[model samples]
Target: MIEAPAARAWPKSEAESLPGKLIIVEGIDGSGKSTQLDLLHKWLVSQGYLVVFTEWNSSPIVRSTTKRGKNRRLLTPMSFSLIHAADFASRVHTQILPALKAGAVVLADRYVYTAFARDAARGVSRSWLRDLYSFAVTPDIAFHFDVPLDEAIRRITLSRAEIKYYEAGMDMMLSEDIMESFQIFQGRILDEYHRLTDEFGLVPIDATQTLVKQQQQMREIVQPHLADIERVEGGDLAEVLRHSGLRGRYLQQPVWAEASE
Candidate 1:
């Protein structure tokens, strides 16, 4: 059984003084949260909102190191957790905070809650993980996409030929068979996610619903937060993208511009 940490106060509340909003999503892999976030990003962009999107563990500073470790299959559970922490920190400093400071709505594919769930599932101390991410700004809205373990497994299997090593938690040695390990490992992650949802007051989204329905529900929840926020003008869009580290990604003119035309 995994050890539960003593209850502590939630991380600092959202900084209301910041002009922009931080919106994040959390869930086990294959829960459809990523798809929902993509749709949300597109909709916000189409409406001319300045949106910055960041995904977990995408920090270039540690990307090569993380890749080498995973390829060599040398990441112990603790080391794996720490590497991800570093990636999160770098992105927070370089990408997330800057965008928030610039008044762009920042959408995170996963947030610190991801480490809280995945690392604890790997047997890292929960309290330690929280402290490691103590510098993180509280998100204005955190959505948890809740899906059953069986359904999650089904979706994953259908989408890929095989599960990757660390993704299946094979490093923990729960099972030799990759598929079996994935089920057990992801089950543990799902359990931790449930605990995090209640502890952090995350808004729960039913992942089993049709895509259209889920998106409708998300837009409804997100609409009020955007009421007074202004749309990004063309010149301002470039500045926002520059600070977001996404200028290269939008080099060919943004699709949103065409949509507006």
Candidate 2:
């Protein structure tokens, strides 16, 4: 494998080395995504890597737009998809690409695959959805946390008392039919993810394990990749976790408020 000198942040060159990789964890909203991210981030850091964790809809700008779209009563599937695409664009420019160039091992909770799967589920033209995310830079690893749709729906219900307006309005989206669609949706994106793996040779970590097992499996999966992880010589998962700043209990601060716009 030929590893070149690391790339610089776009439109500028400080000659900083950026050999670290991007790892993305993706699933439905209620999946234990943040927990796994926290575990992985801390573990990578414990291995002595410089790491950072961010998410789509992270910045205030994206969150504001997401909230507005979420509250609308009659959101067409396509309209909702546009919100996600815009959110992805903001995050790519402001977060993902910058950190990749800086050489930090950046972990993302959700990404363009979300746009692909969710929009395709919503009956959007898959070609157009692909085009919307065609600008996304590839990740070194993208892990899809697979789960039963019924279980996912149950988790979402336990967390939120009411569905978002669009979720509530679509009878098809609310039915087992939709759950079955997740099977098809998952297959399509997994195909895409597999193509990504064949092309970039990504790491895949199964997410069906219990919480403890998930953490352990993630560590095992990432160890070999640590070789490509500059400045991070070893992949002691615990050490990597410490580097990411999310080792202990996480408090979800109320980071979003109504936009005055």
Q: Global lDDT of each model? A: 0.83, 0.59
Q: Per-candidate TM vs. native? A: 0.89, 0.67
Per-residue lDDT over 137-218 for candidate 1, one digit per residue giving the tens place of the 0 to 100 score: 8887888899999999999989999899999999999999999999999999999999988787788899999998888888
Best by lDDT: 1
Give the C-alpha miss distance for residue 46 in model 2, angstroms: 2.7
Runs in model 1 with CA error above 4 Å? 1-14, 233-236, 240-253, 257-261
lDDT (Cα, 0-100) at 74 in candidate 2: 40
Angstrom error of the Cα, residue 76, model 1: value is 1.1
Q: For residue 55, what is the lDDT in candidate 1? A: 91
lDDT (Cα, tens digit) per residue for candidate 2, span 83-170: 7787778776666665566566778887676666666666688778766777677665566666555566677678876654444334
Clashes of each: 0, 15
Model 1 TM-score on a 0 to 1 scale: 0.89
The 10 consecutive residues of candidate 1 with the worst lDDT sum are: 1-10
